[model samples]
Target: MTDEVSISRRRLLATSGSVLAAGAFGGCLGGAPSEGGRSGLPSKVEVTMTSRPTPKFEPRLTHVAVGGTVVWTLESGDHDSTAYHPDTYGPNRIPPDAEPWASETMSAVGETFEWTFDTPGVYDYVDTQAVCTAHEQIGNVGRIVVGNPELDPDAQPALRPPQSELPRIARTRLEELNEQTHSLLSDEATTSTEEP
Candidate 1:
């Protein structure tokens, strides 16, 4: 009787362990669930900020409609989102008519800040903290392209301020994002033209 009880207990322990391990592994593989809004025109999008090890923005790039809003969620450490405009002590990378925006420094996890893009253009921004941490030098930057705005010949970010100031990694990231934004705009243009 004692031997039988020991065997059953061991089997139960093994089964429970397997069940827990499988649950954890499955969750890891599933990734974060996406919460989307509208069809192709998301009303709101989120960008996560982290500062441990290094300060960075997850996704680094975001796209939204002209009136869409972007919410920055702090995941770790401190951060602030500031557009690259003369008013912010950075080059003019946002739309020529768009107003500069800067978020107050946030230090707690789960803290949030948001901005609405009312103009149609590509906007490049950085964490003002970059000045002290050299986050921009290390490629920690964020870009947002609103609507299907036509690219300005003379105001292209790749050829303007900050681009030359950024290091290889930051410049590379911007280049890749610029290509992606261009492709997206091109595709939207094609789609719109075909619709009518």
Candidate 2:
């Protein structure tokens, strides 16, 4: 029995040490964004949907590498992440070759929907429930930038027809998202080019 206890204690200590080490170096992990380069892009990101204090998608904008995946986790209230595509009764705001997606209503807390983005481009999405339309009217929309697709920043999908047909607040938010994506990717390009 003493030998058994000793072995169990040794195992516990080893596990604790490993946990502490991992915690100490957690920031060095791959998922955290790095400075000025495509290498900074994450392979996966989580977006949260909340209803209290007004319905909204936390982060509002996400940046991921090509083939990266985004998981929409419903933290509170009913929500679904739906892309802005003709099939969804909206303009094509995602990459021309990208497949459109729409998550079913997730009403339970902690429920989630995920999609892997294969094409490189800017994509716009929203929680498309009628009750949430009011939330959208106030700019509760989301956008994702998958990799860096060459796009005329000024002519981004948000500024085009049908997509441009979104509510003024939603349009404004998307335009801001587009500008941010352009700035971030452009800065990365400039830095990479300037490096030796």
Candidate 3:
């Protein structure tokens, strides 16, 4: 009985020693430091969405750094990204003529789409699906502004209407008139002010 007790005590000590050794090794490998210890590399940023931000079926994204990548992960339903420029290459799997940078229709619940912007430019995109009648009319659209470090010190990204198809003169005049009316109502007048 004494011998058996001795063996059991030895086994318990061995097990406890092994557990302590493992914990020490994990700490050396940077596992949950107590304080002031360096961690590993930075993690990637992820963005999620349920539906298009625009009434026209477009997802809106703001400015990101020149080398940064924007990943649009669809958490729930179907979606796509159709760029305004037809001449430029778009989502790799999609056809060239579809859109400048259009992504294929993503129907799966966890579908993901990513775009990396290297050049400095303002890119506009839209969802081509016609399920919503007023989608495009009500502005189901998004914009991306890629700015260089030197060109844009403040990195002030902005969204503007596409310049390729200029607004009709009549529409422009009407917008101007509306702006003037608003200014008059607000009692703020300035001849150089422009419509947004």
Candidate 4:
């Protein structure tokens, strides 16, 4: 026999090249196989706010860890996300009743909101609809420093109003210094009523 039929075709091509190298090493270490083949718990962070170039509110600095859970997805226009506790959210700092841990109003486009901090602190938010007219009084604002690695030395530092109530820009030398302090208080009350 031809040396036992060339050693049985070299043992059937080395057992079909070791079964095609173990099916390419198990498909490069087992990938593409989820549903029921089970293996999915990875996205511990994802913050999106789409609508290309015009409608804002993307990432805007979002990070999670302590208890972790922030799933805000409003991929287009129309938005809302109140959460103002850092002293009434903003401008003139509105802390009278301060109630608003979650208030996803007007969430039209795609609409999705999910929050879960599990106590750490500092979670100011905004965007209560009028998306642009003053856009939450300019800057739109957002901050959620849960599990505090920093901000929260007794919090209250997000919108520290008191710079003469911040929101200015109407000057002609501040309107001629308020008309020379109203013409020196009407010439000091007409020279103090001719001195008594």
Candidate 5:
């Protein structure tokens, strides 16, 4: 019994320590998730949950190197970090062998969830809370593109699920979200060129 208790305590401490380290390092790095030392990892990137002018992720689309991580920080509204998988209803966008992850739908500001991309693939995720009529199924979705240095981000970002297969609201929202991403990318390209 004592040994079991000690093991549990040790696990808890280790988990807690990592969480704290992630929080501190992520905060310092402007909200990106912290990763254990690894090669080929592009620095972590962040997707923020915003409630002010709109309830949505700050960067709905993210691109990272194959071994990178994406951090989702909940600022408001009930939300969770959920990967697209058969369990979540699909047209799955993740790699066939990628493990799915989800966070409990909670509204606590500063709550964060992180996932590391090991395989080069497109990963679509969503906030799994039913705050809106189609909250978890629609506008709450985001995309992560884990690209190989040798190739583009792969089929991840473009592997959107069949819109016609979803409920009307979800389909409409998804289309709108895609358009927003398109516009955002276009804007970013223009901005980048202007920078020089």
Candidate 6:
């Protein structure tokens, strides 16, 4: 009877130990944090879509800490948080370990797509959908700087994306936007007081 009890107790302990190990292992994986409170998933960052005097991301550049998430809320215009992954027809800029991820293209006002940056790097995204003929070529894009503010692309850390990708007007506009984002250059760099 004593031997049987000892065996039963050992089996229970072994089962408990395995369960605990599995739970701990899950956190180490690069998956989005399930227990955001316990696993250091920081509060989400938000960027709204704006279309009126200007058709662009409300905040073209976003900053977040590692493990932080960014949710792009579409206030207006058809948009998505399309990461620059091979699948998206651009070199990836997100962290090397991070998988290429994107929010579905949505146009309804108030629709949103969220992504967690589990690793550290810059994640450049674009809204490729055409809105009244304006498209990604016209500067419907944005970026999330994770952990490193001085971030470069994941694959070509040195080479920047070519300006030829966008229309001439858009390329110039995006350059101005990038300058503004890269530097605290101007709060109204993209904004124009002049009548369009």
Could you say which candidate leads in lDDT? 2
The C-alpha TM-scores of every prediction are 0.71, 0.75, 0.44, 0.24, 0.60, 0.60
Q: Which ranges of candidate 1 are over 4 A from the true structure?
A: 1-39, 130-132, 155-162
Of the pair 1 and 3, which is ahead by TM-score?
Answer: 1
Tens-place lDDT digits, model 4, residues 31-146: 11221111121113445555466444554444344555666677776666666444334342222333345555545766778766655444446565674554445444455433
| Backbone collisions counted per model | 0, 0, 8, 0, 1, 0
Per-residue C-alpha lDDT of model 3 across residues 1-196, encoded as one tens digit per residue: 6999999999999989966874554343222223211221111223454554423222243344444455666664556666655443222211222224667767786787887665554445555545544233434455443432222213312122223342353234323333432332233123114323
The TM-score obtained by model 3 is 0.44
Off by over 4 Å in 2: 1-38, 153-164
On residues 20-127, what C-alpha lDDT tens digit does candidate 2 reach at each position?
Answer: 763443222223443223555778878889988878887777777888888899998888898888887467787677789988989999999999988877888987
Model 4 bad stretches (over 4 Å): 1-67, 73-77, 80-108, 113-121, 128-132, 138-145, 148-156, 159-196
Model 1's TM-score against the true structure: 0.71
**What are the lDDT scores of the predictions, listed in order?**
0.71, 0.74, 0.43, 0.46, 0.62, 0.59
lDDT string, candidate 5, 121-164, tens digits: 65667666766644654466776656532222244433454346
- Cα miss at 156, model 4 (Å)? 6.9
Candidate 6 residue-wise lDDT, 41-134, digit = tens: 3345678876766667756766555778777788876766777667764655455666777677787898988887777655566776765665
Candidate 5 regions off by >4 Å?
1-41, 131-133, 149-163, 168-196
TM-score of 2: 0.75
Worst ten-residue run, lDDT, model 1?
Answer: 26-35
For each candidate, C-alpha RMSD in Å? 12.0, 11.0, 20.1, 28.7, 15.8, 17.1
